[model samples]
Structure formats: C-alpha cells, structure tokens
Target: MKLSILDQSPIPYGKTAEESLSASIELAKMADTLGYKRYWIAEHHDMSGLACPAPDIMLSRIGAETENIRIGAGAVLLLHYRPYNIAERYNMLAVLYPDRVDLGIGRAPGGSAEATIALSGNFLENVSKMPETLDELLSFFEGNFPKDHMYSAINPSPVPKVSPEPWLLGTSEKSGILAAEKGIPYAFGHFMSEQDGPEIVKRYHANTKSGKSLVAVSVICAETTKEAEELALSSQLWKIQQAKGEGKKGVPTVEEARAYNFSDEKKNDKIIAGNSGVVKQELEVLQEKYQTDEFMIVTITHSFEARRKSYELIAKAFGL
Candidate 1:
C-alpha cells in the first residue's frame, strides 16, 4: 500500500562521486518530507564508475538527514560480508534508528566478475555455500538463532536480536522460496527482474511459514502512461548500460536518461505508469497478480519536481 525509491547513487555518465552523493542526500530529504515508506540504496562495488558500493556507509549519511523515512540498502551484498559482522552492524543501526532500518539482502553484489571476486576474497568458498550460507545470515540477524533451528519447524527469536526488518531481494524463484521458508519478507528487484514479478511474490506467499509478515519491496511507479514510459525508459537505459558493463557514478536526471532507445515490448510490463485512475487500475492489477494487497512503488521521474509530483499523486490515489 506504500511506495519507495531505489536510488543507485546515480552518478550520471560523467559526474563525480561527491556530486552523486550530494544529489542523493537532497533526494532523500525530499522523499522523507513526502512521506515515502523507505528510500533504499543499491550496492555495487569496485566498478571504476559506480560509487554506491558501500550501502552501510551511505545509509548512515541518509539516516542522519532524514527524520521518518526508513533508510536502507534495497539490498546489502550479503555474500560479501561475514554473518556475525552483518548482524552487529545492522543491530547497531537498528538500535540507533529503531524500526526505521530495513536489512534487505541479496546474494549478488550488483557488479561484474572482477568485482565479485574482489569482494569475496578468501570468502569465495563462503559464497559457494549459497542457501546454507543464507541460513546463517538470517540466524545471525535474528541474534543468536541456533543452527539447528534453521532446519526444523522453529521460530527464530531467542536473543537480543538484530531485528531490523528482513527481506530476501532478487528476481528469481530461489529468492522467493528463501523468503517464504524463512518467514521473512521478499522484495523482487523489478528494475532487473526478468518478468514474473508478480509470480515471484505469489510463490513466496504460498510457502510463507505463518503468513503474518508483510510482503513487498520497491518497484518504479510513475504518473501518466506517457510519463511512466519515459521514466521506465530512463531506468531501462541504466539497466542496459550497466548490463553492457558500463559503470558510472551518481544517478541520472530524467533528461540524461531519455537519451537512449528502447522497444515497447521490452518495457511494456516492466514498469507501472499512469494518472491517478490509471495508477489505481494498474496497481490493482499488479496487486491481484501478486496475491498481496501491500506494495512499495518507486515514483520515478527524471526530474526532482516530477518525482515529487508523482509521489504526491500516487499517495493521494493510494490514500496513504
């Protein structure tokens, strides 16, 4: 029922890291004032042009500036950090911000072959463990959850838990299964998730341990079908460029994003765009397809004003 933003510390193709951070700070403040549920940052490391490699560092800065918004990594590169350390860092932040911090987790580092190796280091064997490694992570965050509890029909609250909201973030069915089996929330990376965004959500809910947790994450939402298509194009361009292994710092403005070309088939269902009525209809369809009434949308516009306006319009339409 709420919306959110996934800012990539977007350094336009030519901007400096400092400039990108500054722009993100401004954008965070704007989102905070607008009453968005959360503003999550993506983590991509070691790429010569990407700057948001460390979301924890950036999150502290975002948290320091915002009052009510839940600031977090749309995903932390869980495969890169130690389970114990991840727990401790997020626990400290949760204590500092209380209920406002979310620990969205993803196996991917949002980078390349070289970047992944660099991050894993000797931890390479660790990443290979996969879902087993994933269990350790969830247990660590739950603050001392024993290894055995993860396998049996067990609940995971036993110690001074690092209870920041937990979310399994990815585009695949595996991520969805992880969320449901563990009783955690699931966030599909719609920006990069290759179709079946709703189906992923459905799979998670169907297997949910107790069906008590709220299931949702961030997806770009825009106003007017045309505006939506335009913003989606911008997002798609970044995806395309990033996939081609072109790394850049900072986020791109709407204008900078519109410079690329795309096909309707590629974007038609990937993003949600429309006026209030259109938004309502579109979201309703998405909600039903996902089998959940809750969702977090990213009101994407290339310009700040347009983004803000899109937020306002969606908020009013959603009655949030």
Candidate 2:
C-alpha cells in the first residue's frame, strides 16, 4: 500500500502560526526521505487552528526543501480564485519541481461565511459555475482549448515539461461524478465526510477513464494504542469547540482537552487512533473497501513531536 500525507499545519494552543508552518515544511522533508508518495498541504482561511491559507505558497517552499515526494495543495478551495491564476501558480511549481507537483482542486468554502465572502463574493454562484471553471482550468493545464474558444489565444505562463497532476478532492458522490466526467484522478475526503465513501469511490472508478483514486483519512499512531488515544484528545476537543463556533484559538493541549466537560454526544468518529499495527490493519481494511492502493493520512496533535512521531510510526508499520 502507498502512504501519503495531508498536512493542515495545525497551530497548537501555545504555538504560533509560524511554528506550525515550519513544522509542515519539516514534515514534508521527513516524508520525502521516508519514501512516502506525496506531501500535500491544505488551504484554510480565517481558521485560527489551521495555519495554511495559501497552499501554493507553502508548496513552493516545501518543494525547495524536499527531494522526491510529490508536493501539492490537498485542496485549493477552487471557488475563491480564477482558473487562470491557480493554473499559473501551480504551473510555476511544476516548472520548479518537475513531475513532483499535484494540483488538487476542491469546491468547499474552506472558511467561515464571512471569510468566504471576504475571499470571493457570491460563493454559491461560483459553486454553480464549477463545471465550466474546471473545464477552463484543465484547458489551461493541457493547452487544449477549442479552436474558436475565447481562451484559445492565452495560456498559463511558464508551462512545465510535465504539467502538475490534477486531482479533484471532495466528500460526496457529486464530486466523484465531476471527477469521472472530467477524467481526472479523484481523492475522497473520508476524514471529513459522513457520506458513503466506498460507494463514491466505486462509482468514480467505474466511470473515470483515469481510474486513479485515493482516500484521505484522519489517523494518529503511536507506540501504544493508549498513547495514541491520549494524543488525539486535542483534535477531538477542537472539533467539538469548532462545531459550537468557539474554536478561534489554536489546538488545545491534552491537559485542557481532558479538563473540558465534553458531552457523550460530542464525539468525533473521524479520527482513527491506535498503535502502528492497529492503524495499519484498519488502513488495510479501508484500502480493500475503497479498492485503492494509496491513502493520504492527515494527523494533527497538540505536540509537534507527537504529530511527527505518528507519521514515522505509520511509515515504519507500512515499511515505506
């Protein structure tokens, strides 16, 4: 099985945004050396806990620091930006990193309602125009606009020898259908969605000519299952606080998480916490169900060391 990383660059309670971003670069380098398939950074706006707002910028720095692993935006929140702008930015990264760049597009707002408006007015309208926008974006990458098309006269600058691989990232069957129709790779956000992932992925494979798919999962691994669960408390509490519209600060410490009076209903089933062996076994089960060999693992913890160790343990378990 192939393992990859989806880094949100979470800012722990006491850590600064700078620290969280630096940790992302370090993690990317580590993943490169550990033989992971890719290192993807997420884009989030006006989210205090998540540091990254422009994954394209982070990818440039990470590309300079890493050697072989593919670097990309886990999802660039395509609703906010123009197709030409995104194409130029990632195309530049492809020029710099050659075949090691990926452009994972997503339609979610990726921020608060106010932030969404701040980034791009009429987000709902943009969502409705996604199909046409995606077609234009791919046209920019492939330089395949129709002969009489208005955009045929222009192209994204500094196109690389190999255009960055494009993958549609989403949590629903709608996204799967879009990706299949576009004939690009699909990445199912299993970590965030409550939808039927296996069915979505199966449909994507059956319809897509590309036949490429992966599942991005939330995971936390440690030397022991107890330690992993303890480390996960911070993320669990953060999600609870977020749903209640109170999570403006960075991720809370384990001590703070333990002290919080979480109701029995305030549980996050998305996080998979366990030792290396247990995580591997569960991932294997997911791989079989999803019928994909690649899994993008996203792990966030209060301590940077714990987050790093989680990836290391998983890598060792998979012998990557």
Maximum-TM-score candidate: 2
Q: Tens-digit lDDT track for model 1 on 47-115?
A: 644457878788888888899999888788888877667766777777777678888888875676776
- Per-candidate TM equals 0.80, 0.98
**C-alpha-based local distance difference test score of model 2:** 0.93
Clash count of each predicted structure: 10, 0
Task: Give per-residue CA lDDT, model 2, range 81-153, as digits (tens).
Answer: 9999999999999999999999999999999899999999999999999999999899999999988988899
Clashes of 1: 10
Model 2, residue pairs in steric clash = none
Task: Compute the lDDT of residue 194 as modeled in candidate 2.
Answer: 94
Q: Over all chains combined, what TM-score does candidate 1 have?
A: 0.80
Candidate 1 has its poorest 10 consecutive residues by lDDT at 151-160
lDDT of all predictions, in order shown? 0.67, 0.93
Off by over 4 Å in 2: none
- For model 1, state the Cα shift of residue 13 in Å: 4.1
